[model samples]
Target: MTAARAAGAHADAVPDLVPDAAPSAAPDAVREPAPVTPEAVAAARHDLYTDGITACRGAFGAEWADRLREDIEAAFDEARRRPGGAVGRGPHRYYVEIHPEQMRGFAELADHPWVRGVCEAVLGPEYAIVELGFDIPFAGAVNQPWHRDFPSPELTRTERRLTSLAFNVTAVDTEEDMGPFEIAPGTQWEHGDGFEHGMFPPRGEFPRYESLAVRKYPCRGDISARSALTLHRGTTNHSATARPVLVLGVDAPGAGNDAHHDMAVTRAYRDALPERVRAHLHCPVVDELAPIVQKHTIEGLVMGDA
Candidate 1:
């Protein structure tokens, strides 16, 4: 199937998280929505993410949104910021990095039952974060490249089962041309044995996968959640305005790449995970706060790196 389509082509009431072989509910009927069990949540996430693309546009609340925007700006003004912490790899876009406290601001935004429902349905309660990268509209462009996300299991011996969650919040209505995301659905299930990066190594490297239209969720706060190992990309933002978002790559307690080694702040975030979660993430865990990762794109006033 469609890999549990969320927020588009259908009414907002219908959850795309339902399986293709789902037995209950009439074609037109929205069933008595059931609570997602940890196992089912994991399975549905797997089913939904096998191709690796889902969107939860507008999932963050209004008040929460404004506050986060401010935090991002402030964080950007500071030093020690990594352009794209987790989700984004290179610069097809612009971004504002926020601190953990600012990230926590959106934590409560999950107060809405619908948001929590989606979280429960996809990640359940055992989830731990991999990294959070916030994006702001670049002065004149937008879009993502073709790529596949790897689960934590492949990167480290410690974490073999990783469930990743990501969200892209928009501040404006993304009309067809304003800015959209492009994706290949159901690629998460693809075996990576023979695949290679599309642009790397000079060896005909390419992310092996499919291309579907990026999911467009309704209103502010709608979100797309999924497991990792999905291939995806973003549509170039043709809009003169900006498309701001927070990209969180969360994995089942202990999934992370080794590249994060020795970063105090990143390690602190990793260390904060539950003991069990720590054991699952392959990255080093530290108790210290990370160095200031935010460096301003504007004025040269230096905010010393932590």
Candidate 2:
């Protein structure tokens, strides 16, 4: 009958939002378990990634793959001009490239309807984009130490906070053998200053949080994101191929979570996004009072990169 109906037939909503897959030897091998259909992948993704929900992959195709490729390319192009402190030789990663149109387009993916529902599920309709970015791990990239993006209040500090979220482009497609990122869900809610920067390890070396990292590493051809408070990290990219990903940040509209405390600096980078894309995500629409878009800096872990 209905897709949601069928998904619900075999699965009960799990607290994590990401319910378990069909009983199989490769449980976390990326699947579309019944009840947790691709339609529900976002729901399951959010749950497993954030509120502890999980679903299965019901839909997959070339169109989806191509779209992912395009976005990854756009993000990379944006990253080239983007700036931040350097970690050895890699990019500092401070600006989010996906503008409104891209954000809307990404949400429109037939296979990811659950993403919108999940975002609405947590923050409600008024929720504006908090933050979104793309990650391209080069062959020699360093391990993005275990950490959690804190939902720090904005400069205005008036209840304005954004949540951390993401989806996979599967540029490299991860399995136990290879990986782009590894997640430790709910550790964002685990309530501890855990890890080097408050992150939950996906596997070994975490003599502490490793015990809770029971979830299998997500295989490639998957999409994932987490609540504002979820603990995670972009572990070392062991694969020879560059692992590219499109990242998204979700923050309420008009809550003081703009580029940063320095409106001028915010304008510089926010203005840097593709004009068309910016118009799509208009959180008051990028205001270019200045003639030339230039660089400016923020105070501290302002979150959302730029």
Candidate 3:
């Protein structure tokens, strides 16, 4: 069964992190009426708070997802050839941060009502789009250490508020062998000493994360949002085919995630974007888009282990 169809079969199995399937979206529904109900926004906020993640199945369509894969492949090829463009997550896994204009469906993905509603609810109305990227785990990619994308910010540690979010859209139907993403529900609240670079929790903490882990099988067109501080990792990929997923990062004002990324737009591309969409991108408007020179490399991940 397609992931969307399989969601129901597994919903009862994962009560806390089960995908909240939205209404079946038409081909153009992603771009239609943008207003979102307060109830939906409240539920999304609640899920993020309780589970540290949430998802909407079949947010777009298979065709739209295929287009995303095509764009990702093209960008990955170009990044592979440039020094520092593609950073290694493990032996066979890579992460590349690209400009929004690099992808054809970026605007659609960013402007979707679900995306907007979640951002508004969790990060506030002035949330900024700070990063656009993708992660690919090819054959031979090994299980990653349980870790957060970064150290929990002060707001999260002291005030118990999430300051940033990461939205992921798998470019293909994820299966058991493709190193499906795994996350430990509610681990975003855990923070203590012994974390390397304030990201990877020490191996002593692995057992708890493993016991609480839920392997996510998000199909093409499925989208999930999560606090970047959540404890999670990519499992080993035994399939020969690579699994690539788009990553869009948003931050509340003063989150400081923008300092880690170099997201830019050409003057013309910036001019063409809807004001509502453009308002979220806080980056330099350049005369010409320059090939990004990656500066924020995760040292712990570069060695394939912590």
Candidate 4:
């Protein structure tokens, strides 16, 4: 089936979008039973709209979390062993995209109900996965400048609304010293060349916004959903180990035609996934997955040249 048709089939299976507010309940009331209930979906939608991001703790169980962590570590090792496997964009930042086929354990998360619910609420029911990769910042890696995932400074506020969402899953417990992900709350609404440049102004120029940046320390299994336009950065990793986070991009139908980060999985793998999951992955399926290698440097990382 065509990619668009696949996306439509996937959308048809999603539950109806929920309202922005849940039923009134006391602060001490009992919690909902389901992991992605209508109430939970509504609250997540509200946060994404108001704060530009939502952090869902324990979104996945310990079993899934443990498997993903192990797979990620194995992928890292494999990448390093392969010729030109590890691409260094900076002192300690390694760029790698673990093909979905190789990391099936983590790839299945794309079809998890809770994940689909959030994507449906934020990017509409017709959303599709445009890219998936691993972002590993090892010890001594420098902080990344604040930036947006896409460049579209000319789009109006309404034009940019919910066009794409980024779902990040941490592979390990993110501690303060680990240089967790940080973001400027509510900055997703800001538009213009300054915010669209894909890199923020120097700290001296925007001290207040820089100072207001909040650090997010999410434990393993936590999922963070945010607009692709949000102002955020990956902080420096000071610990002895590497910090690897899985990054998945879901875009509203027709929103990512010009995206540069498109990825492809093997045909066998694509055919193996359930129809529900296949719909989200609309990219081409190749006969064999190839290694992605790129030059790495601090300047390249800051400029996004890599």
Arrange candidates by lDDT, highest first: which order?
3, 4, 1, 2
Model 1: lowest-lDDT 10 consecutive positions: 297-306
Q: Best candidate, lDDT-wise? A: 3
Off by over 4 Å in 3: 1-36, 304-306
RMSD of each: 13.2, 13.7, 9.2, 12.1
What is the TM-score ranking, best to worst? 3, 4, 2, 1
**Candidate 1 Cα misplacement greater than 4 A, ranges:** 1-60, 79-92, 95-97, 109-125, 137-139, 151-162, 197-211, 215-218, 257-291, 294-306
State the lDDT at 250 in candidate 3: 97
**TM-score of each prediction:** 0.56, 0.56, 0.87, 0.78
On TM-score, the candidate that comes out on top is 3
Question: Residue 167 in candidate 2 has what lDDT?
Answer: 39
What residue runs in model 2 are displaced by over 4 Å at the alpha carbon? 1-60, 81-96, 100-107, 110-112, 151-169, 192-205, 214-221, 252-257, 260-280, 284-306
Task: Please write out the lDDT profile of model 4 over residues 83-181, one tens digit for every residue.
Answer: 655555555666666567656564567877778898988778778887666777767777776666555444426565767778888776667877788
Residue 127 of model 2 has an lDDT of 55
Number of backbone collisions per candidate, in order? Answer: 38, 35, 0, 3
Cα error of candidate 2 at position 234, Å: 2.0
- Could you give candidate 1's per-residue lDDT for residues 51-167 as a string of tens digits? 454443334445455455445544433321232332222333444444444455544443333334445555556554445556553323444444444422453223433345554
